[model samples]
Target: KEDYNRNRPHSSLGNITPNEFAMKIAMEKQAA
Candidate 1:
């Protein structure tokens, strides 16, 4: 389960893992 949640890249999320997507959003918000 840990591997699936953190290691897998989701097609719906532009082929990025959920952790990566969340980090990207966080960085964007900080930049804003």
Candidate 2:
């Protein structure tokens, strides 16, 4: 589960790992 969240790239996330995508969303929310 850790590897999938940190290492695997997701197609729905523009090929970025889930961890990165979540961080991006969190930052966006904070900025808003």
Which number leads on TM-score? 1
lDDT of 1 by residue, 1-32 (tens): 99787889999899999999999999999999
Model 1, 4: alpha-carbon shift in Å? 0.8
Candidate no. 2 TM-score: 0.73
lDDT per residue for candidate 2 within 1-32, as digits (tens), equals: 78866879989899999889999999999999
After superposing candidate 1, which stretches have Cα over 4 Å from the reference?
Answer: none
Query: Worst 10-residue stretch by lDDT in candidate 1?
Result: 3-12
Q: Local distance difference test, per candidate? A: 0.93, 0.90
What would the TM-scores of all predictions be? 0.77, 0.73
lDDT of 1 at 27: 100
